[model samples]
Target: MRQDTLWVHREFRQLWAGQTVSQFGTYVGQTVLPLLAATSLGPRPSRWGS
Candidate 1:
């Protein structure tokens, strides 16, 4: 294979790895933040304007 082709492949692999990790972190944060908010804030009264 040509050197240029090899470089392209390496760059693609790096990009794929980065995107995968970023997506995983996003999913973890999405899952964790709501749980944290619920635990910390507990229930609140309705705000339907008195």
Candidate 2:
């Protein structure tokens, strides 16, 4: 079978599912961290340097 056809395999499906979940978590963390930092520290540039 060709490499493109390998997605039908069970292992590939599971790997794809896990990778999807992990990527989603990473995206959520990426979005949330900046918001958390903004809220917790306020929107001042001076506070960031020190």
Candidate 3:
């Protein structure tokens, strides 16, 4: 008897691989964008109103 599994299908494997890579890129962007924004901006003002 042949084993049945989603991994056995070529299209599912391709889709799974693509999704994995997309998710990783999303995580990396979410982490890095904020750090970049904070570093690029100037320090906070000492007082709200002078």
lDDT of 2 at 45: 66
lDDT, residue 47, model 2: 47
TM-score of each: 0.51, 0.53, 0.61
> Per-residue lDDT tens digits of candidate 1, residues 1-50?
57666446977889889999999999879998899989999988978957
| Candidate 3 per-residue lDDT over residues 1-50, each given as its tens digit | 24598888889889999999999999879998888888998578868668
**Superposition TM-score, candidate 2 onto the true structure:** 0.53
Kindly list the per-residue Cα lDDT of model 2 for residues 1-50, writing each as its tens digit.
Answer: 56679676989889999999999999889998888898998866674585
Candidate with more favorable, higher TM-score: 1 or 2: 2
Indicate the residue-level lDDT of 45 in model 1. Answer: 91
Please list the residue runs of candidate 3 whose C-alpha ends up more than 4 Å from where it truly belongs after superposition.
Answer: 36-50
Question: Model 3, clash count?
Answer: 0
* Top-lDDT structure, candidate number: 3
Q: Which consecutive 10 residues in model 1 have the weakest lDDT in total? A: 1-10
Best by TM-score: 3
- Candidate 3 is scored at a TM of 0.61
- In candidate 3, which residue pairs get closer than 3 Å at backbone N, Cα or C atoms, i.e. clash? none
